[model samples]
Structure formats: structure tokens, C-alpha cells
Target: MRTPLGGNNLTAQQYESYPSADDTWTVSFNNSAGTSGTYEVYAVCLPATQAP
Candidate 1:
């Protein structure tokens, strides 16, 4: 992001994600920028198959 006077308002993004044994995901993020912005979150899932 850019400021009015040609300054950088952008900050480095830090995040982590992992799946738990219970088949759930944990998502974490840091907002170092201290600014609110629009973000879109989505996921594409597939059925789990058993190993015969």
C-alpha cells in the first residue's frame, strides 16, 4: 500500500497454518501494518478416502 505523500504503508505479512489430528485447521496471522484491509478467504476441500 502507498500513502498520499508517496510513502510505503505496507508491512511484512506473517502467518501460519496447520491441520490437526481431529481434521481441523488452525490459521494464524499478524497485522503489523496496523491497518484494516479487505481480504478474501477460501478453501477447496475433498472427501477423505480410506486406505483399503
Candidate 2:
């Protein structure tokens, strides 16, 4: 947010996802309010390796 808006003019975001038990994930710039225009979400996961 830049200028910062009032409570009445609040902004929000949400998502639903089903990830693996070994999945690594993170979220950023979510459920925020203000006079801005920037939001992002990131997720990183590594698959299970097979036996040699």
C-alpha cells in the first residue's frame, strides 16, 4: 500500500489449494488494504526421488 486507504475501502485476497505432504510453499502480499497495486504468491515443491 502507498497512500493507505480507509477501512471501508479495504482490499483482500484468498485461495484454496491441495499440496503434497512434501511440498514447500509460501504466500506474500495477501489480505492487505491500501492505495496500491501489487500482489504475489509463490510455491516451491520437490517430487519424491525413486530408489536407485
Candidate 3:
């Protein structure tokens, strides 16, 4: 998490995964200060043949 001001007080409160062919995770964050920022998440995808 990147906060423009008021310091970085981002915490991952909870995480959940969905049941599907493609796995996906949902993350919840707690920012008590309500600071303006961007929350970014990334996932790695590999082809069936490339994955071991």
C-alpha cells in the first residue's frame, strides 16, 4: 500500500479464496486513518506445460 500522506497504516485484515477453475484471492485491508493511496495486487500465471 502507498499512502500519499498521514503515514502508511495498511494492514491485511482478511483473505479469502474463491472456488473456481482459476484461483483468485480476495484481500481486505484496514486503513483507520483513511489515507489516500493505491492498493495493488499481482498474480502469476503459467501455462499448464510450463507449470511444474
Candidate 4:
């Protein structure tokens, strides 16, 4: 779980991981500093607890 938010123009980023046997988890992004921008992505899902 990584949350990095920047300001003075805004540049927020987040990353989460849960992949090895593959339970499906992948989120990639890249603008590479090309002009023209508009971005807002959010995902909050929590309901997974099993390991006893």
C-alpha cells in the first residue's frame, strides 16, 4: 500500500499489490511528460480476511 500525493499543480499516485499465484491485481500508468492532462482515478475496496 503506497499513497503519494503531490501539490502545487497536483500529482497524486497510489499503488497496491497482491499477485503471485495471480488473484488478479494490476494498475499501471504513464504520461511520460507529454502535454495535455486530466487524471482522477480512485479505488477503495476492502473485504478480504482469511488466514488462521
**Which candidate comes out best when scored by lDDT?**
1
TM-score of each: 0.46, 0.28, 0.37, 0.30
Q: Which ten residues in a row have the lowest lDDT in candidate 2?
A: 1-10
Residue pairs that clash (backbone atoms under 3 angstroms), model 4: none
Regarding lDDT, does 1 or 2 come out ahead?
A: 1
3 against 4, candidate with superior TM-score: 3
TM-score of 3: 0.37
User: Please, what are the lDDT tens digits per residue for candidate 2 over residues 1-52?
Assistant: 2223455554655555445455544343445655454444556456679999
What is the C-alpha local distance difference test score of each model? 0.54, 0.50, 0.52, 0.48
The segments of candidate 1 whose C-alpha lies over 4 angstroms from its true place after superposition are 1-26
How much is 43 displaced in model 3, in angstroms? 1.2
As a whole number from 0 to 100, the lDDT of residue 42 in candidate 3 is 55
Regions of candidate 4 where Cα sits further than 4 Å from its true position? 1-28
Give lDDT for model 3: 0.52
Tens-digit lDDT string for candidate 1 (1-52): 2223335464435376666546676555665887665444444458899999
Q: Give residue 15's error in model 4 in angstroms.
A: 9.0
Worst 10 residues of 3 by lDDT: 11-20
Residue 6 of model 2 has an lDDT of: 52
Greater-TM-score candidate between 2 and 4: 4
